[model samples]
Target: TELQEIAPKEFEGRIKRQGVVNALDDEDFAAAVRETGRKKLIIAGVTNDVCTVYPTLTALQLGYDVQVVADAGGSPTKMADDIAIRRMENAGATITSTVQLLAELAENWTSERGGKIIPFVMGLMPQQ
Candidate 1:
């Protein structure tokens, strides 16, 4: 993949890339998000404390509406993740679930896009 070329071979598939950033301050990532013309962002990362919080704070500072998917943003410990979530919330980032975001985008179940989206959403969600 393109990421394998840009990122070091050591990274391999472990890198979850929205855009390439080798540092905590990621101008390229911010620019990439801006290029998409998307003001609202859903942020997740392997280590929630540093990886997720840094970008979420940056996006919030840049006047973007940010949502941090708590479950998706894993941490070394639950305490660390909780702390990061609290910090993000304090900085005006919304803590949300993947399901909530998908539901918002999909809207009604009867719509054309909804037909496709529902199945995908169902796969993400457990039978209830």
Candidate 2:
């Protein structure tokens, strides 16, 4: 998974790797958000089949708005990826790019978060 690639050995620290769960099924993701005390959540994983669909569907069912980082999360094949995106989108999930998430998290360009984020953006940008 990309998360593992990004931070090898550290990914498991934050992920509850049950390898997909009934807890992530439609009604449960909502209860999870309420229980965790955080309105904001970032959902991502491999294989759009279960990882993306189950949790996204669950999160939406729970009334917790979700921001799915499509670029950060991907499926096994291009077709599988496209299908997953379309399926989730039809289910009212809003798909987003990795950069979009950073921008959204920052929320405003004139604030302190924005000022502090330029370097991170610069690092992510490809060399011209």
Candidate 3:
């Protein structure tokens, strides 16, 4: 419900939606990931501790590679956020900034797709 509500209209027909009542117990999530036939995941959620951490831990347990976007995940406090990030890292999930995530996805600055990606990614930079 929340996923559908929050997803942009442009992605309506294209994106798959799954509900996790408690991420730790969400079998559907694992099923969906397996359905993709991809082992790597880039994850972010509304709350860093419970929302993000639970799913990440589960993914690790299921043998999928995981990366969490620190800036995109939120927590009740900075301390909580730090703790969650450390926990994920200790559990073997790579913690990354959104910029790094985008850059990795774009792969190269000189490529044709990078021409589009680089500008959008650069727009996210902080002004000097």
Candidate 4:
């Protein structure tokens, strides 16, 4: 309910599931991903070490391209975050920032999709 409230209307109908620390371990979550027929997955979680890393590694093994949004996930400490990020990188998950991910997705700033995304991303920047 909270997610539906916060998510954009278009994504409110997307499949969502509460699962174990490793999302791939949950049958429904894994199934939903497979149903999408997508090879690439962009993921963020409450914590990088436990919540993000586990599923990222598993997803890589399952032959999906996984990108972890570094700033979107947290860890108990900087050391923990660093190690988790390194671990995921070593296992072949691309570690990206929210802005970088958006740019990659949008591709061209003059495009209609880019025009929409650029404003949203710019809003996320810190004021000078």
Using TM-score as the measure, which candidate wins? 4
- Residues 30-110 of candidate 2 have per-residue lDDT tens digits of 454577887556777655665767778777776767767787767778898998788878888888886787887788877
- Using all chains and alpha carbons, the TM-scores for the candidates as numbered come to 0.75, 0.72, 0.80, 0.89
lDDT (Cα, 0-100) at 93 in candidate 1: 96
Please provide, for model 4 over 7-54, each residue's C-alpha lDDT reduced to its tens digit, 9 standing for 90 to 100.
778476665666577988988788988998999999898999999999
Give the higher-TM-score candidate: 3 or 4: 4
Root-mean-square deviation per candidate: 5.8, 4.1, 3.7, 2.1
- Give the better candidate number (1 or 4) by TM-score: 4
**Tens-digit lDDT string for candidate 3 (1-128):** 65567675734654334676346475555566678898898888888887889889988988989999988878999999999999999999999988898889889888887777898688899889
Please give the lDDT score for candidate 1: 0.78
lDDT of 1 by residue, 7-122 (tens): 76745535244554332255654456677897888888767887788888888888989888887768888899889999999999989877887787789889987787798788
Error of 4 at 110 (Å): 1.1
lDDT of 3 at 122: 81
Off by over 4 Å in 2: 1-15, 21-32
Q: Best to worst by TM-score, what's the order?
A: 4, 3, 1, 2
Global lDDT scores for all candidate models: 0.78, 0.71, 0.82, 0.90
Deviation (Å) of 71 in candidate 4 = 0.8
lDDT of 3 at 15: 33
For model 1, give the 10-residue run with minimal summed lDDT.
15-24
Residue 8 shift from truth in candidate 1, angstroms: 19
